[model samples]
Target chain A: MSVKYIPVQWNNNKWKYNAVMLASVFAYLWIFIFVTPDLMSNEGRINGAVHNARAFGSCAFLMLSVILCIGPLARLDNRFLPLLYNRRHFGVMTAFVAITHASYIINWYFAFSPSNKYEALLFSNTSYGQLSGFPFEVFGIFALFCLVILAATSHDFWLKFLTPRIWKRIHYLIYAAYISVVAHVGLGILQDQQNHTFTVIFILAAIVVATLHVMAALHEKKHGDPLAAESGDWVKVCETTDMQEGYAKIAQLTAKERVAIFLHEGKLSAISNACAHQNGPLGEGKIIRCLVTCPWHGFQYDVTNGSSPAPFTEKVPTYNLKVEGNTILVDRHANEPGTYVEPVPLNIQGAAA
Target chain B: MDQAQAIFFAFQIWCSIGALIALFFLTIGIDRIDEDAQGAYVFRLLLIPAILLIWPLVLWRWFILETERDAWPNRHRPPRHAHFWVAIALAVFIPVIILVSLSVRQTWPVDFEPQKLSLLEERKS
Candidate 1:
């Protein structure tokens, strides 16, 4: 987080992440373009542009599949959370690769056509009325258009300007893009291929993506139901002994609202589970030196007042908390963002005894 | 022109107008609308493609913010069940599409007479 928005809030981790990502992408492209063809027999060889187009196209599809899986994977396990960070960079790179694929196709196939290249791309196959020979290029174009929009608005400035809700809604277009890509591949190449290897892989990839989403949804549904408080207006989160130091116990106020009650410095503090930036799950974060750091992007907030440190103005709503015997109860109602609330002292030894 | 070509032509025209609007909006209107965008020139350039695509909405929001700054409502709720349903729908839709396409696929006609030769004779020949 920053007071003034620069191009990117680059850090050591972002640099390392980009470096590894670029290296992997370059390695994949090189191996696919050069190594695979040499290993294959002469009969399996394809034209240079066509081979490059396939390499980049397949890589883009794989990257997008991985990008879609990251969110659900993170939800299923904490270890996958690192992949969630620098995801926008992954998305932008995938868009670049996809554009390269499109470029190769345009230059190779449509360059000699009488019409403009882009115009030819659209009108080359007008069999939209038929199911067998439908213009799958249109689907590819639509997906690319969606991807470009997403990549362009990926900056945090758009997040702040569009408001997180609108930003999130716009990003959901990725799902549409994914579906379009599935159609593009299925209708375009799957129809022509005599060999079933790629067809099986494509289908399996789509199934895996869909299955992971469904499983994650089920997991969330199982844990997301609102817990009824033992008393009115205050929800019993957990005993003092149950909470580990610097970690949080998440209380679901409703299906939509959640409170993160953190145990820090022998005291308990409750704040909104949603981070101010991108609404990342603050409940999953760890607190260090009185500041709770969001697991997704490391946006930090003071556990006591739910405000970020000086110069970083991000804030989450604070909740009033009281200790009764060994139990910690949080007020269901939240204070306004950045409101100061006294942390409840935790008697961990007494609770254990 | 065909329907597809007509639609493509219309989209091209829309984007042409959108590019012009995007230039003005990024330079001047963005600052007036969003304070975070103030002096953030590099990020504005990144937003060109999105602004070119959704220029109508951007212009509307810019106009609205001129009257009431920061009036856009923000929601921080966890995502709804729509994503799950969409995923399920696509899962069902994709396999069905693949099956239908394969079933309806056209096969080339063969116009040769049947050979009466046995495997040994065919091999020898």
Candidate 2:
């Protein structure tokens, strides 16, 4: 949304989001480090690097769990869309916390090793052949690597450079990272600890993330299927009276491409449902002042041309539309991005008042 | 050397090279290729870790940009379906791994006891 790239396009919303997130992280760390040990009996008390590592490690795991949940939650409900806005910052912070956790472990456990600390971390455990001690550090290392890469590339510059498709492909490593983390905890900590707290928490978090995703997929499959073509080269989207003012009715074409048919000022315009930024659901966004605003990041496009107003160079494919009686039909073929299509004027008497 | 050590040694070398390439790329090569990167400093710093890991790809892209100046490949390709399968695999793998780990957990010989000899017995012997 910027003509020139700055470090972050900070807004009031971003500041509030980040402040809340940071405060929560600090509070969690404080509770885990200071409050938890006192709650335990004297014989069971934990402190030093062990306590610190657990504090940050568990915090990072929880943060990652929350991060994974945001996508599905946003898909399921619009109330969760605010969480999706500053997710990159959340991810980067999680990486830093994870790094701190790793640092505490390395400094404490591998401090006396003859070789390099990192080398010792990898080489000290050679029980890969055995299932019980399968060098769970490898899984931790893989997860850390993925997190680092993801955190590093979370910038918009990388998104533009790598292209959205490739960037998205790279970010899919988050799933692998999450799975690796689950294995790392399961094999390393759960195997050693008699306490089932972490085990239960990890199991529940994984299940919740997986279940939310499956639910979201099911929801999309049920509601997002393309509309069948009713006539030649056009698909009936809805009745003219059914179109909401300043809102879009999402129509899925035969090619599985979604078209957001917007109603504004007794006129209808159809554009690609995908937003140029992060592919946010443009159909879910509300139209204001003849411009449709993407709900996720607030990237806006002029409804008629499917192009962001000058100074911002984002665009989505536009589709031709027609009205027969009260039925709204959109052309099967989409025009090139930024191509302007004449808005089909509707009779005010026939449209919803 | 063992396989783990060997792999680590190779990785160390790769990272060492990547670090150098990342340094060069962030400082100079990025601006040369991408107009948007010309004056931006903070984003370049953020790119360090990823560039270090994928320096070869960066170099390849830089080389391509050096020749054509604007041939950004794969910018408009449709999203791939490979990640879906990977996700499905991970979903299945997570529970299976936890179960496998639990089932194969090693048991320690907790009943083993150490025998002690009395000082008097030792002296008599």
Candidate 3:
């Protein structure tokens, strides 16, 4: 009900970092385009330009995919949440570079056509005229359109105007954009009948990433049912104050909500045992940097917001905790907002909950 | 069919197949995943790249399979504010300029040797 993790000052540094990343990418593209010589013969130069644009496009797409992956990884593994914090920067920058590359291809294909009037437009439409009119280009154009939509909406103001849910739906266009770029590479480059190596590489890379996700998903399905994973209702195993130093204990709240409570640095923290993004149980993950990091996907929620340090993470609910006398007791009735559940402490010595 | 026609037909068919296969995998894969995993975070990561490779498939999946839970046409509401339009315009403008400049910079010069010019003319024709 209450928005727990909403901060007073949306981090200005985060926006600045995004701006710097985008500016740097633009600078790099500017240098590459201006400094490069046009010494290659007409066909040769055009081919070279397309090739360079594609290489840049591929890299941009890869960066965008990684940025998109960060939030899931953070929710899956809280240690990785930091990566999600800067994901928008990466997404916007990748969009910028991709736009540059898309424009280059459009120009290289259209600008220098010597055909007059109708003939030129007709020629451009022919298969041999514009990089063989590879359907990939059409898809590429469509994807670029999506990227434009996404990049435009990336700003916080637009996000607020659009509402997180609506803005989020539109942002999903990036997926369509990714597929378009892939088709652009696959058909325009791989299906070229002349170049197979790069196509194969792209296919392989895609296969691996897709496979990793599938395998992870399968693993979660097989072993990740929160309700089935534990015995009994999630019970408060210890009093809030009874948790000693360097300690971790499992609490089963309901069959669906299992948690691990940890006492570290004289503070008590609790978190969902299951990863928020992929359902990887936190109970099995390694704790690093005072956060429980999911082994699968690597999402990290702050032990305090169930909010990830990362910007785009899904929030996991944290429970209400109180210290009563020497005996540890947890009320199953009241759950509070913004309580970050810490991972189970590895050892029991010198700890307090 | 001639060689060019053959290539076009082949490329078209291949893309169509690729699009279909991508849709197939995405549907089955997405259906199998749970609520948390299917959330925007993982969906963006796993599906975005696949969509990049095969957009029609992704669009079909997004509109038909994914958004179907709500409804098709009304799944995405148009933005209400003038600022939303402004944002869209700015996005389009930035890319349009870059595209135009790149086109201008790469424009071919008219002056050239007559003999070699004929070769280009022949190629064009």
Best by lDDT: 1
Q: Put down candidate 2 lDDT per residue, A97-119, tens digits, no spaces.
A: 99999999999988886777777
Off by over 4 Å in 3: A1-52, A65-85, A110-134, A156-172, A193-197, A222-225, A228-318, A321-353, B1-125
TM-score of chain B of each: 0.70, 0.66, 0.30
Candidate 2's displacement at residue A2, Å, is 3.7
Clashes of each: 0, 0, 43
Tell me the tens digit of each residue's lDDT in model 3 across A1-353: 01221222246767676777767666645544455323112224356677567556756766655654554355345577556555655775677778777666656665675533223322344453343343455666677767765664454333322334455557666645655565555555443333334445555554444444444444444444332222233333555444555444555555444565556566666655555443445554545556666554466666555666655445555654544343333445323434544433233343342
Docking class of 3: incorrect
Per-model TM-score, in order, reads 0.87, 0.86, 0.46
Which model, 1 or 3, shows the larger TM-score? 1
- Model 2 ranges off by over 4 Å: A38-47, A225-242, A254-256, A324-327, A331-333, A348-353, B20-29, B59-91, B105-125
User: How accurately is candidate 3 docked according to DockQ?
Assistant: 0.03
Report the candidate with higher lDDT, 2 versus 3. Answer: 2
**Residue-by-residue lDDT tens digits, candidate 1, B63-95:** 766877553123455454466676676677666
DockQ list for all candidates: 0.37, 0.37, 0.03
Calculate each model's fnat, 2 decimals.
Answer: 0.42, 0.38, 0.00
Give the CAPRI class of candidate 1. acceptable
Instruction: Write one digit per residue (lDDT tens) for candidate 1, span A15-120.
Output: 9999998998999889877887532122464688887888899889888988989988988888999999999999999999999999999999899966777778
